[model samples]
Target chain A: MTDELVLRLLARLHGHAGWLAVAALLHPVIVLRSPMRRARGAAWASTLLVSAVAGLGAGLYPSYRALLKQAIFQQNPTVGWWFERKEHLAVGAVTFAWIGLLCHLAAARADSTSQKRLAALAHRAYAAAFFLALSVATIGTIAAANRSF
Target chain B: MTARSALTAASAFAIVPLAYAAQRCVEVGLGGELDPALVPPSPRIALFWRVGVSLVLAAGSTGPFYRLAERSPALALRVAEALAALAFGLLVAQAVFAP
Candidate 1:
């Protein structure tokens, strides 16, 4: 298949995955609040979703730079900058989701007192991830709408 | 939680901001031409540095951190939390301020 076609497919999947990541990240934020809640499943889902989105973004990036980036900058420099910051925050969103996943897994193995602490930490981490991913998704949507390949 | 797992998580979390900060510093310090391919795009290395530094740090930090965790779990947790807070602050500052 052609590179353009590949990038288009990746762009489509990335857009869908970005939204899925935002939604998946919210699950542990709510679910892991209770001391009894493990949330391992939701935690893993969010991590995978965000990671997948990031991976897809990586695959699409070269094409993005060659094709859409200059055009977007020409249209609106502000949105172009927003896209830059969004990429940075996307790093945070994906990384925090990973941290939350590790924490959730550790929480499952820990003793009761330690488990609660770890789960609470995971809850906060997931919340942070959710907010960042949400911001990334919103900015990304605007950027794509403004100019996409 | 095991020390190894805790440290791995901490390393992964801490590296995110550290990687970006390093990448930014190198971009600014080394060359002005490579500032993320804005308009009159000349030869740019910003994307290469960004991806390369992040990959290296994320891959390299876990082993040393695991050793640290083995020595002192309390210290490891405290350091990780501090680093995570720093990471959060860095994100906000960059989002609001980066050109």
Candidate 2:
């Protein structure tokens, strides 16, 4: 029963992953082109949703480990700290990425300069989010590795 | 900067806390769970930080800068540039003082 449950969960996760990958590929092209841009906008939204799911999946493992470390050892706090901070950063990154993709898609479909500006803003926001996440993750990883565990 | 441009800026500032907040290490007692026990239950400081962060994020979400991004490539580029700078700063800080 346990094995069956695990398999079902894994299968669901894989399905979601496939969707996210497709959306990720489709979104950027939609940003540049027309007509298809509307369809792509929907895809972008879906992709962001999948990204959030994937991120949570990725986070769970580290979080679980952190919980174990805190519970058993109770001596070091580095890994646990890293886990939490990384999750927050990941959330921010995805939010920005979605916003950017949405803006870009809308701008591509738009005919006005003002609409284009919105697209650009979204791109900037996404980039900022990505970098912010990268920094936090990198630092946390290093800190955890060097920590007195 | 127009409304959308302003939102972008707000969003950037809102995210800045993520960098600094991650760096903060509050010494606390582990409770074998996600919640750690801080030595002192000082709600004021915690409240202040949460409020400040909420303001930043709220500004980004509610401001006009995001809307402006749809139209102005220049504004978008400018905001992107600023965020890039922030990202760089955050990376350096994390790398240098992470431990």
Candidate 3:
């Protein structure tokens, strides 16, 4: 019971962090779209949050497999694959956010022409990150709804 | 975009393929699942090595790419693009032709 409770709590925290990460990822998208070129704070926050949230999910995976994987597949086979797809998309999310961050940092130091191009790339990258992160959160919720630890 | 920006874009894009490659690494090489065929993971690979390490390597590689771009922007651009293309191709091949 204690172990179950711990896994449950960790799962809840992971879900919450995933949502927070989605929001954080959006921050860079919005900030970059605006006249303000500031990206360090929000960009860093999003990248760190997404990476940590992904890490937390990793921490919970063993428990999830032991406790819930079979039940989830039994209940709905497709949801199981959706869960896998979620993981794949999460990889994309992390990459997009990292890409955005790298570009934003480089944009600050480059010449004006390069800066403009880098910043534009950052904006697009963050937007893609935000979209993928949101998709992951949604898929996660659906997966958990089917069966959760 | 300048050569440096080209390198940045290519390096950044490398993250996806790199992360997927990392997951494949531990799953196939170390987990005793040496099937030698690209397939979706059983329950997904550990994100630490998959995502975290890829993020670090892709991000770190950019620094060298930037310096190289400084000396030979055109060469750096070509190398970065080629590497990124290669990685992307490997990722696609794996995804599409999984046994």
Candidate 4:
């Protein structure tokens, strides 16, 4: 694929991932908070899906950066700083999402007391990850606005 | 709750900085230049410094975060949520207003 096409695809993926992250953030409160087995199961499934999407977006970032090196990084320093910082934040988000997934799994298998604790922590991690993902997406949009080419 | 799960969470957090460090090293080692227009002025030195910083951050944060979660899950969750909100605000400001 052409560089432009690839960038566009990645951007779209990032956008969708950001939206999913937002949805996933609410699951801890809406779904996981429930005492019902079915709700907890749905929460677990949503966690996995959100993590996968966030991971995919994070994975594609390097390629996007490499492609835009000249147009974004080399052309201006301020924009480069913003983009680099955004990338770092995205990495944190991706890592947290994975960790959150693991925590969710552990929670599902835990006994009642442990399950309660793990679920709480997992929800927090998910919140952090979602916010970071949102930041990354917003920064990407801003960076694109500043692109020279 | 289990030792194994705690270890896994800590490891996961640690990997973030390691991955970032590796990416920065490769970017520089593979002929990626730090934009001279940015601060520090020396790309090679800046690259090494960044990698070192990342390593230090990973080492410093992983254990503390794990402990925090273990000791006070509620507090940990509150802190994480607050930080996330702060991060969001900062990024939005930077994007919308920063020169």
Interface RMSD for all numbered candidates: 2.8, 7.0, 6.7, 5.9
TM per prediction: 0.87, 0.46, 0.72, 0.57
- After TM-score superposition, the amount by which residue A133's alpha carbon in candidate 1 deviates from its true location, in angstroms, is 0.7
**How many angstroms is residue A16 displaced in model 4 relative to the true structure, after the best TM-score fit?**
3.6
Clashing pairs in 1: none
Ranked candidates (TM-score, high to low): 1, 3, 4, 2
DockQ of each: 0.44, 0.11, 0.17, 0.15
Fnat of each candidate: 0.32, 0.00, 0.08, 0.10
* Tens-digit per-residue lDDT, A1-149, candidate 3: 69888888999999989999998998889889852378688888899999899888878876766566666666676787567657766776776677678767767766665566567767876886787789889999988877787
- Across residues A1-149, which tens digit of lDDT does each residue of candidate 2 receive? 67446644653563455345444534443443442233445436544664665455453343334334344224445554554455444444554555555555555544475455555555455554446445444544454444322
Predicted candidate 2 versus true structure: per-residue lDDT over B1-99, tens digit per residue: 344444465445435444333333221122212343233222233323543564465565544556646666466545554654454455334433443
Query: Could you give me the TM-score of model 4 versus the true structure?
Result: 0.57
Model 1, stretches more than 4 Å misplaced? Answer: A1-5, A111-113, B1-3, B25-45
lDDT of 3 at A22: 98
Q: Pick the candidate with the highest DockQ.
A: 1
Give the lDDT of residue B37 in candidate 4: 49
Question: Which residue pairs clash within candidate 4?
Answer: none
Candidate 2's C-alpha runs over 4 A off are A1-47, A54-69, A72-78, A109-149, B1-52, B59-61, B64-77, B80-96
lDDT of all the models against the reference?
A: 0.74, 0.46, 0.69, 0.57
